[model samples]
Target: MPPGHVADRLAALVAERESQIVLGLDPDPARLWPDAGGDPDPAVAVLAHCRAVIDAVAPAVVAVKPQVACFERLGAPGWAALAATVEHARAQGLFVLADGKRGDIDVTATAYAHGFFDAGGLNADALTVNPYMGLDTLRSFAAVARPAGGGLFALVRTSNPGAADLMDEPLARGGTVWERVAELVAELGDEHRGPESGLADVGAVLGATQPEHLARARELLPHAIFLLPGVGAQGGRVEDLAPAFAPGRAAGLVTASRSIVRAHEQSGGAPAAAARAEAERLRETAWALG
Candidate 1:
């Protein structure tokens, strides 16, 4: 799975699915579904919730991004549920991204890559990566992701307000730390290009909640894909995502998590029904904006 091979698979999947959003599955035990047993095993409850959300939203989105911490906390049982959920998503023709944000040097990074991108994996189609470790640390992950036709969304400017403490700090080399991260995204994407749109395989995670950074990030990584998180409950407006689509409709992926999955709480309707409606609403709004 070289860069070209994986890029092709991703592009084709997105095209066929007619979606760019990757719904994140981050189940919190304290917020278990209403029907969940009082003494319900946290892992079992999470697995059920994930499946319900996937079943509800799969038709509207192309992929699902599961946060590893949510599952890791449940230990082996949690991992098993994660693998099962991933299999279900694929069975429904949806791509999966393990949102672990894993990063380290050499072999450590390489092993992490194998865990997420390998064929025998829980069958993830991509994973979020932390580029703070330097471009070299990403080599092993890239090696697996590129060839398998999987992908990585390197963190650049996260949505959390506290990110300014570091990500927005000025660097001695010039510009801010995030600017350097943007440069790295552009550099890694220098090779792979989309067959039709000319976009690249490498991408950056630029939170949609921080619209101000979108324009600059797009400029820096002109050819790289952009994964825009923080929409819906996070206060990111779909209308503010213009810069992300500058490269074209397929350029940026608008991801939402709790907002879509927990819509039932707001609507006072059946969880599955509410979740489906919410995902469709976001999909419609985002598609129009893009």
Candidate 2:
């Protein structure tokens, strides 16, 4: 039999695990494991660090989100590292969400869609996509990912302080642009809803920092998964995100990057131990809200 659809598959995983925590692997060259030390090739150091993080945090997380920019900056080798990271995450039986935020139109977008396909080295359960250009630009991405049991997370309201400058600007049509984008995402997701899951494959990239908007966003995209970023290091409290689970606990994926991986610096313990502890704390806290 064929694999289950991506939307239903993700929902099942979340339900089975009883956890919605997504681990963010954003390895900085400056903060790599002490032994990753002194390497001229940043990719080498990054790869070593990522594998270790995956090993350390696997048990506590339901998924792994590898930052594409961090690896892409290292050029070809960085690409190699990202591919390896995705493979390792899958091997550990965790879902992989490629946090690349890719956006384009026509042929260019098609090429990008191919990159995230399961047949490629960068195969991921889902990919973070940008819908700034237009909702139409996202068509190709959704087209490719959906059929392959993969999905896309289109940015709606981002976590960065600067996001308001563009995403929050009011449009003549009414409300902020992000609100309009949310509507589009809802439609896209609905079009591809899983018959068994009652969820959509086109998820949204929402920020945990703006939890207040969660209710409204939910009103618009009831079926799409909301990838809530900015928790922990970004000062987004998990308590404020209950609305994201309005659809169900499995509907929201709370993401944390520097917070878990670098917890040892502030909490004081072995890096791996601190990271695991922090991840468990987050998982427990989030699971309680619903």
Candidate 3:
């Protein structure tokens, strides 16, 4: 399917679900599938763990954001597993957000666009991209994304502590660099607005870890959806992300991966069962907030 078609479907899913929770699939090798046995192929174990987690949480969330690095580290097998995960998510009626954070010159950016958005490739409904190269770079990728109906979540304010170094720097024209990124998110998103949801195709990733930024980000991109990461294991509070939904409760998407997947450790139960319980818990909490 084309990318724009995917975005439309995702918008409908978000509205129908009345919940914008996008569970992240950032699998940490050591922590995930520890019981898969130290075989020659750890990637297989990771794939199994990822698929199990997806099955456990698919009913509670609208989308899944897979951190590409986790797969990349495992080489070819990892990429294969990543592809399988994407297919699995789609089969379950969930959108897949390829969280690669790729950005570069126009030519390379276009390739990255193809790598994620192309029909024959991974076939993701949306992908997270880095916009540091400039508006033109994003514009290049957006050209491909807009037509396909795929969405891109530009990184604005990340959850990591080191983000303050660059994102917090004051700019001559206005607020911080992160604020400028928000402005770009709005401007670039002008073309992809969904008529029903009043949300633009271009979105922003505002870490749930930094709830305060939500207020500012919302002001900048009122019509854009905010992909809120850093929740659960990252210490992002659900209550703090309320501003992301000022336009509507569906405006903010709460994402969690490790917190739910590793929940078995605390529950002292089967991994799949514990994971499902954690996902349901997060779903209930996020819905209540919505």
Candidate 4:
């Protein structure tokens, strides 16, 4: 890997932390930590909840995936909160993957990239992008991310049931839409492959809910890191995701939102303590796969 490539940085962090969990921060204003609700402003409450969650789980995870919509709904205050959340995660030594799933063409794509990768913006370590518009859209994101030592995780086969509507469609050319998308991800990622880690700056969002597709996805994206979501609350098991770690421990990042944050609801304990325990459990399980 290049000295300062994003993939190299990610791999280094994974080894240092001895974990591959990516804490998903999809904060719902109506459902924050009990103490956070004391704040009148929803955005402030959300930020407090995020900080508490990070503080609890930072030691067990290598990164945080912040769902942008969760913060965007509150307008300016929410955006400010999102920025603060990213900064706080960084302060805790966790990578920030801004989950906007943004897609566009030309200058618009460049603008979105800037919002996530440039100075004074979120300055995320990576961003989730929608590749439905085609590879050019990804190119725009890479154009910005590469220079900033950032990365991009393109939505290949998402965890949502609705994804089957488009992603699973049999192409007339004799492959599935997602299979074709995987090919594109491989094609683009090859250009920026990390030498030491054998990972690419460009990666794939392969939902962990569908383990059957993982072997096939890995076949197509050998060098791309897989952001495997859907564990715990979404019913994805860590054992089924072993294929994603074939390249190395950092090759797959298991992201869990409600599974860790709302653990108190199921385990019945203090929110932070429950969340910390859940995150540690997930970290241990995923680390074993490597």
- After superposition, candidate 4 runs with Cα above 4 Å error: 1-3
Off by over 4 Å in 1: 1-4, 35-39
Against the unseen true structure, what C-alpha lDDT does each candidate score?
A: 0.82, 0.87, 0.82, 0.93
For each candidate in turn, the TM-score is 0.94, 0.96, 0.94, 0.98
Best by lDDT: 4
lDDT of 1 by residue, 73-178 (tens): 8999999989988888888887677899999997899899888878776657778899998988766678877767777888999988888999999988889999
Q: Please identify which of the two predictions, 1 or 3, would achieve the higher TM-score against the true structure.
A: 3
> What are the per-residue Cα lDDT tens digits for candidate 2 across 90-173?
888888899989999867887898887758558788899999888778998887787788889999999999999998899998
How does model 4 score by TM-score? 0.98
* TM-score pick, better of 3 and 4: 4
Candidate 2, after superposition: displacement of residue 106 in Å? 1.5
Off by over 4 Å in 2: 35-40
Find the 10 residues in a row with the least total lDDT in model 3: 1-10
lDDT of 3 by residue, 1-290 (tens): 53344445666787776657787887767777555424557787778778878887778788888999999999999999899989888888887899999888899888889888888888787888898878988988888777777888999999899999999999998799999988988998976677767778888988888887787788889888888889888899787777887877667788888887788888878877787788877777877776
Give the least accurate 10-residue stretch of model 4, judged by summed lDDT.
1-10
- Which digits, one per residue and each the tens of the lDDT, describe model 4 over residues 1-290? 12388998999999999999999999998899997656989999999999999999999999999999999999999999999999899899888899999999968999999999987788899999999999999999999999988899999999988999999999999889999999999999999987778799999999999999999999999999999999998899998999999999999999999999999999998999999999999999999889
Clash list (residue pairs), candidate 1: 1-147, 2-147, 6-149
**lDDT of model 3, residue 34:** 54
What's the C-alpha lDDT at position 257 in model 2? 88
